[model samples]
Every structure is written in structure tokens, then in C-alpha cells.
Target chain A: DAGVTQSPTHLIKTRGQQVTLRCSPKSGHDTVSWYQQALGQGPQFIFQYYEEEERQRGNFPDRFSGHQFPNYSSELNVNALLLGDSALYLCASSLGQGVNTEAFFGQGTRLTVV
Target chain B: AQSVAQPEDQVNVAEGNPLTVKCTYSVSGNPYLFWYVQYPNRGLQFLLKYITGDNLVKGSYGFEAEFNKSQTSFHLKKPSALVSDSALYFCAVRDMWKDTGRRALTFGSGTRLQVQP
Candidate 1:
């Protein structure tokens, strides 16, 4: 089966610009989560979407938001982006909202804010 | 709040030698732990997870992790390291109590493993 897929493998945007990254979760999965991975760092949770609603969010600012569709695809939006926003955006998918479930990740979208 | 810590920034080991990447976690309740490996310019690949059962959890690519509840640590181990096994390793956790309605993982800073041939 095709795993989680993310579009726009690489992107470049100027500071203050807005960016939207897309993700299609693995088949048979329903929950999608977004994370940010800076250079030389691990992935940081941004937020999680389940049942088309944001279920949980990390410590990130309001500038970061996301949406999940009926097809289990997701979109991560960042407004008023700063240079620090330049990082690899990872999309993960799981079967349910359970701690026992393991998340499958996408290749990630590398966003470069100039 | 739950958190994970991978104390080592990098781990160097020779091929055929055993390797260990340390990880510690903090959670208000039972911790669901996980280990992921990332290659250069790639996403996190799930290696293994510890939900319950035995302390030893075996995962992909000849890797295993030992969960020590008293120590609150989950350390990834490999019996014999291979050069191709070199990559960035991350430790993640979810607090069972905090995951009542939401499930978001708390990740460690990651540890780079370099297995020299």
C-alpha cells in the first residue's frame, strides 16, 4: 500500500509570506498529524487532526493551523512566516486516536523562508 | 506535559559491534514510547514502540529497545551494527493520561548514529 504522501517536496517563500503544505495519509488511516523538524533537531509536534477537527495542538503559535478532509488528506498552513519557520514539515498518519497506535510519516516538505 | 530526551547528540560504533542509543522519558501516567530512524533528507521511519508487555521490544532492521520503568528510560539496542545502519534516531512518547482525547507525540532532540565499517 502507498504510504503517507506529502506534496511540494521543497518550497521557498519570503518572510511574512504564507505557505500551505499538503498531505495524503496512508490508505486505511484516518488521523493525521503535523510536525516541524529543524536542522539538527528532531520532529516537533505542531498539531493533530481527527474527525475533521483539530484535536490537539503543540506549543506553536497561532500562525500554524491545519485541516483534515474526509479522504484523510491534510493541509498545514503557516501565516506570517518567519525565517525560523524554515524547516522540514512532516505529516504523520495513524489509524486512531490511541497511544497504542504507531504513526506512519511522509517524506516531508522542506520549507525555506527567505 | 510529556517529554522525551535523547542525551547523546551522536553515537559512533564500529561495524559488528553492539550499539546503544539512550533515551529517557517523563509522563504523568503510563508512557507509550516509540523509536524512529531518519535517513538524510527523509522523514521519520517508525522503528518500534513500547505499549506494554515485555520490557524488550524488537523492531525493524535488527533493532530492539529495552523499556526500564523504574529508570523511565527506553534505550534502543542493536546486537551487531552495520555501516548501513547509520542514521538519525529519535525517541518519542505519549502520555496515556494526557491522550484521553488527543494523541500527539513528544519527541526527543534525536541522536545521530554513525556505524563505521
Candidate 2:
């Protein structure tokens, strides 16, 4: 089976502009979560989407938002992007809200905000 | 809050040598610990995890992690290292406490493992 898939493997945006990254979760998975990996750092949790609604969020600002569709695909939108927003955006999919299952991740979208 | 710390910034080892990458975690309650590997420009790849039961958990490739409850640590180990094993390694944790009600994982800054051939 195909693993998690993300769109626009790489993207470039300008400051004050907006950008949207997309993800299709692995088959048989229901939950999708987004993470930001800055240079020389591990990924920081952005937020998690389940049942088409946001379940939990991290320390990100309101400018970062996400949506989960009925098909289990997800989209991450960043408004008023800053140069610091440049990082690898990763999407992970898991079976449920519990920690019993290990998450599968996509190759990630490299966002370069200029 | 749950957090993970990978003490080493980078670890260098010769090919065919055994390797160990250390990780320590913090959580109010029982912790669900995980190890993920990432290649350049790629997302995190699941390596292994410790939920309960055996302290030593085996995962993809030749990776295995030992969960030490007393130390609150999970260190990834391999009997023998390979050049292809060189990559960025991350240790993540999730607080199993129901009160936290958070499913997102807290990851460490990551440790780079370089297995020289």
C-alpha cells in the first residue's frame, strides 16, 4: 500500500503572503497531524485533525490552521508567512487518537518563505 | 507536558561497529516513546516505540530501542551499523495521562548519526 503522500514537494512564498500544503493520509488511517521541522531541529507539532475537526493544537499562532476532509486528506494553511516559516512541513497519519499505533509520515513539503 | 531530549548533537561510528543513540523523556504519567529516522529533505520515518511490555522493542531495519522506566529514557541501538544508517534520528514522546488529552508527539532536537564506511 502507498504510504502517506504530500503535495508540492517544495514551495516558495513571499512574506505577508499565504500558502497551503496538502496531504493524503495512508489508507486505513483516520487521523492526520502536521509538524514543522526547522533547520537543524526536530519537528514541532503544529496541530492535529480528526473527524474533520481540530482535536489538539501546539504552540503555533492563529495564522496557522488546518482542515481534514471526509476522505481523510488534510491541508495546512499558513497566512502572513514570515521568512522564519521556511522549513519542512511534514504530515503524519495514525489509526486513532490513542498512542497505541505508530504514525506514518510523508516525505514532507519544503516551504521556503522569502 | 511531555518532552524528549536527544543529548547528542552528532554521533560518529565506523562501519560494522555497534551504535547507540541516547534519548531521555519527561512525562507526568506513563510515556509512549518512539524513535524516528529522517533522511535529507524527508519526513520522519517510524523506527520503533515502547508502549508497554518488553523494554526492548525491535523495529524496521536493524533498529531497536530499550525503554528504561526508571531513567525515563529510550535509547536506540543496533548490533552493527551500516553506512546507509547515517541519518537524522529523533526521539518522541506522548504523555499517556488521560488528563493531558493530547495526542500529538513531542519530539527532540534530533541526533545525527554518521556511520562511516
Candidate 3:
């Protein structure tokens, strides 16, 4: 089975520009979550989408939002991007809603804000 | 608030030597702990988790973690280090806030492991 897949392995955008990163969760998974990983840092939770609705969110601002489709794919949209937004955008998928379920991750989209 | 701390930013070990990446956590109630590894330019891979059971939780790639409730720590360990094992390691805690329906994994700052051949 193919693992979680993300598009645009790398991208560069200017400040205030909007960007959308896409992700396809692993087959048989139902939940998708987004995270931000700065250079030399661990991935930080952004939000999670389950059943086409945002179920949980982290400490991120309103500029960060996401959507989940019926096929369990997801898109992470960042509006009014800032310099600090330049980081690796990661998408992880899990099979269920429980806290103990293991999550499979995508390679991530590297967002570079100039 | 729930949080995870990986005290070591980097760890170096010779091949065939045992390695340990330290992690400590703070959370109310029983904490669900996890360890993940990320290689260069790749995403995080689940290593192991501690829900309920033995203190030592064995996981993928011959890795294991020790969950200490009293110490509030879950440390990852490998019996023998391999060069291919060099990567970034993260410790996470599953949390749920009282006033919010937010239940997700919170990660540590990460620890980079360098295995020397």
C-alpha cells in the first residue's frame, strides 16, 4: 500500500502570498492531521480533519486552515503567510479517532517564504 | 497543559554501542506516549507507544522505550547502534484539554542521533 503522499515537495513564496499544500492519506485511513516542522525542530501540531470537519486545532493562527475530502485526502491552506511560515508542512494519517492509534506521515511539503 | 521534552539536541554513538535518547513528559491523567523517527527530508515514522501494559514497549526496527510513571519519562533505547539509524527522534504525548474537544499528539523539540561507523 502506498503511504501518505504530499504534493509539491518544495515551494517558494513571498510574504502575504497564499499557498495550498495537498496530502493523500494512506489507504484505509480516515483521519488526517497537519503539522509544521521548522529546521532542526520537531513537527508541531497544526490541526486535524475527520469526517470532512476540523476536529482539533493547535496553537496556530487563523491563517492556517485545512479541509478533508471524502476520499480521506486533505489540503492545508495558509493565508497571509509570514517569514516564520517557512517550514516543512507535514501531513499524517491515522486509521481511527482514538488517542492510541498510530499515525502514518507523508514526506511533507517544504514551504519557503521569502 | 501536556508537553514533551527531549533534553538532548544531539547524540553521538559508535556502531555496536547501545544508545539512548532521553524524553520526559508532563500531563494530567494517564499519558499516552509515543516515539517517532524522521530521516533527512522524510516524514516522521512511528517507533513505539505506551498505552497500558509492560513498562518496556518494543517497536519497529528493533527499538524499545521504557515508560516510567513516577519519573514522568519515556526514554527510547536500542541495543546496538547502526549507521542507518542516524536521524531525528521525537517524543510525543496525546493530550485532551478540558474546555475543548481538541485531542491530539503534542511533540517534543526532537533529538538528532548520529551513529558513527
Candidate 4:
């Protein structure tokens, strides 16, 4: 079974440009969450999608948004990207929104904003 | 709010010796804890989790973590270190009672482990 898969593996965009990152959750998972990991730092939660609706959101600004497809896939969109937005965008999947479920992660899309 | 802390920025150990990477967490109510390791350019790989039962949880790569409720710490340990084991280790936690915190895991800053020859 393939775990969570995200694409494109790496991306580069200029300031004020928008980019969309896609993710396909692991075959038996129903929930998808996005995280951003900057260099030398831990991942910060961006948002989560379940049942094709946004279930939860972190402290990110409105510039960041996401969507979950009916097929359990998800997409993360960042508008007017800032140089600070350059980081590894990670996608995690879990069976449900419960506390006991362990999340499986993707290799992540390394975004570089110039 | 829930949070995790890896006290050490880096841990160095000799190959073949026992290694420990410390992690402490803060959360209200029952806590669900996890440990993940990351290679150079890979995603965070789940090592183990502590949902309930067994303070000692054994996970992949012969890694085990001991959950101490009183200390609010979940430190990862390995009986013997290998050069290949050197990587970034992270500790994460979820508060079961929080309506919002349950949806995501809060991770620590990460500790780099270097197993020397």
C-alpha cells in the first residue's frame, strides 16, 4: 500500500504568485492534514480536511487554504507567496480525526519562494 | 493548548552504545503521544505512539519510548546505536479532551542524533 503521496516533489515560485500543492492520502485513510516545516524547525499545522470539508485550521493567515476532494485527495493553495513561505509542505493522513489514530506522512513538497 | 519540547538540540553517542533522545510535552487531560524520525530528505517516519496502556512502547528501528505521566515526558531510546540511526527525531502530542487539538498533532522542535564510530 502506498502511503500518502504529494506532488510536485519540489516547486519554485516568485512573490505574489500562487501555487497549489496536491496530496493523495494513503489507501485506507479518510482524513488529510497539511503542515509546513521550515529549515531547522518543527512542522506547524496548516489545516485539515475531512469529508470533503475543512475540519480544522491552524493559525495560518487567510492566504493559505485547502480543499479535500471526494476521492479523499487534498490540495493546499497559497496565495501571494512570500519568501518566508519557502519551506517543506507536508501532508499527513489518518483513518479518522480521533486521538488514537497514528498519522502517515508524505515525503512533502519542498516549496521555494523567491 | 498542547505542545512538545525536545530539550536537546543534538545528541551524540558512540556506535554500539545505548542512546536516548529526550522529549517532554504539555497538554490538558489525557494525552496521545508519538515519536517520528526523519532522514535527510524524507518525510517524518512514525516510530511509535502512546495512546494508552504500556508505559513502554516498542516501535520501528528497535526504538522504544517510555511515557512518564508525572514528568510529562516521552523520551525515545535504543539499546544500541548505529551510524545509520543518525537523523532528526521529533516528539508529537495530541490532547484527547480538546475539541480542536484532537484534530492535529503538535510536534517538538526536533533533536538531531549523531551516532559516531
In candidate 4, which residue ranges exceed 4 Å CA deviation? B96-101
**Candidate 1: residue A51 Cα off by (Å):** 1.1
After TM-score superposition, the amount by which residue A76's alpha carbon in candidate 3 deviates from its true location, in angstroms, is 0.6
Q: Which ranges in model 3 have alpha carbons more than 4 Å from their true place? A: none
Please, what is the TM-score per model? 0.97, 0.97, 0.98, 0.97
Per-residue alpha-carbon lDDT of model 1 for A1-114, expressed as tens digits? Answer: 999999999999999999999999999999999999999888898999989999888889999998999898999999999999999999999998877999999999999999
Compared with the true structure, what per-residue lDDT tens digits does model 4 show for residues A77-99? 99999999999999999998987
TM-score of chain B of each: 0.95, 0.94, 0.97, 0.94
Error of 3 at A24 (Å): 0.4
**Which runs in model 2 stand beyond 4 Å of their true positions?**
B96-100
lDDT tens per residue, model 4, B27-62: 877879999999999999999999999999999989
Question: Which residue pairs in model 2 clash with each other?
Answer: none
Q: Tell me the lDDT of model 1 at A110.
A: 100
Model 3, position B105, has a per-residue lDDT of: 89
Q: Give the per-residue Cα lDDT of candidate 3 at B24.
A: 100
